[model samples]
Target: MVFQPASGYFCRALGAVLVIAATGAIAFAQLTIDADSQYRYAQSRFDSGAFDEAIVEFNRFIHFFSTDPRVPRARFQTGMAHFNTGQFQAAAAIFNQQTVNYQGLPLDNEAFFMLSRSHARKGMFEQAMLDLHNLMAIASAADTIDQARYELGWLHVDQGRWNEADQAFGQITPENQDRFQVLNLQQALALSDAIPTKNPTTAGWLSIVPGAGQLYGQRYQDALTAFLINSGLIWAAWESFDNDQYALGSVISFVGFGFYAGNIFSAVASAHKYNRDRVAEYRDLLNQRRQMPLSLVPSPGGAALCLTIDF
Candidate 1:
């Protein structure tokens, strides 16, 4: 049988099309299989606490399935993997991106919470506070709000902003006070009434009346410190005087005099600070009373103190 060139050419073209289609379908199947395998591997790694490995696999899954509906979940898992591994900054970045990319998504609250924690860990206190506020604003469940409020209080405490911390802690409802929330609230209340030790000049306050400034500053131990320091200097001056060392005595006297002067100044300053703090506290109480209807009348068994520390 003689082969017609035209029929042979048509056959060749048809075969080429079939080969191309088969090759494309196989590539697509292989791609799907690889994606499924990567996703499973990522999940397994996460389950085993191999966060770094999980992150790599999750990233691969995300890269392969960028347009897939499961992409958000994959990204979220990747961020969580980073968070579990203590790579908070990287986790935060991922979470932030997730929120931006998937706003109004179901995972918004989780992403916001993670971002807030990351900011807190990184010492970006103001940003953390804002994120916490965002979480509270968007939280649908009471428990979630309570948790966010508790974390917010700790963030304030970490920054030494005790008044704000107290306010945050006070938001927790009594019935929902978990051990963590209750303990943190108690700590916040204690810290609220106490002055922070950020100022080293507090030491100078003790120099004035031996322990007067420290006592005013609500640092009883610091008062003893001031007294001991002054006593030691005074004793040194007395010994110099008794030994008939006029020059040495004069030098010690001068040093003592400066310390004494500093102590007096510190005492005055500390007293001023103490009074100012007390006034502020009273003002805050008044403001609270004004804002809440419950504060209109005193309770029959005395006012319900939110949280009070004995010492």
Candidate 2:
């Protein structure tokens, strides 16, 4: 998921003011009343899950009471409304502001928690983890701690850091255990140990044989394709040279050389890509395991099969 700005309705509603004059002959009007009333209506609408109307009202509240002390609370509420409606970015911004302006307020921890959630929803795992860390540091509430740890583990899982995710999940106490969390951690930990093996250097393999690097990198199709093309060119070059067609042989020889060069380059690139993919896979697995209650169990050789068979 990615973060996106709020809809234009809030901005538009904030910009337009409907001023009602108390008397036709007088210019005096109920400015404060209008703002408060609009805010109250928005709150009521939000309570009923009418996010669209709530958004309209909240925008008006911000517009009318931009300097009021209640503005922070209003902003937080607006952000929650946006979140419930699936506006992740909007919710993130509101929650962030709530944290900054109402640091000592009782809702500060809640704001931080929501900020983490918004970041997670947007796939900003690093940012979400930072917020979760902060929440864990400051929040003493049992439920809050549990929620933060669970979300933190999820962020790790999203990034494929299975070990880290396992650690995070392991922090959850038995009192807070849930079936979903347990199952998720088990799956992530299993994946961490289930990836296919790969050779360290494709270059070494390619040096031994033209397309061996590609094969080592598990690119069987590419290896076969390169081998066929290069072999054909080599054969053609040899045949021309044997028939005393020096010029034709020279051209064919150069073509074969080009194929050889390309094979080497492809082999190096494949090796690098393979290594990167391997790291990413492990990292993501570790991240998922971070939220689980299970810890990493070390094996004698630092590797072990995650599956068992009954024979």
Model 2 lowest lDDT segment of ten: 302-311
- The CA-based lDDT of model 1 is what? 0.68
The sequence of per-residue lDDT tens digits that candidate 1 reaches over residues 1-311 is 87778989999999999999999999998766565667778879987989899899888888877786567767878887887777879989998987664343336656776788777777788998898787777666776677678778766656656677677778887766763446545553664455433233654544456877767677577667767777888999999999998899999889988777766666666656766666466445423322111111122234322211111
Stretches of candidate 2 off by over 4 Å are 1-57, 65-73, 77-93, 101-107, 117-124, 183-187, 200-208, 244-250, 267-311
How well does each candidate superpose onto the true structure, as a TM-score?
0.53, 0.61
TM-score, cand. 1: 0.53
Model 2, total clashes: 27
Model 1 segments more than 4 A misplaced: 1-33, 132-206, 211-229, 238-244, 254-311
| Residue 71 shift from truth in candidate 1, angstroms | 2.4
Q: Quote the lDDT for 207 in model 2.
A: 40
Collision count for each candidate, in order: 3, 27
lDDT of 2 by residue, 111-140 (tens): 787788788778787898999888777777
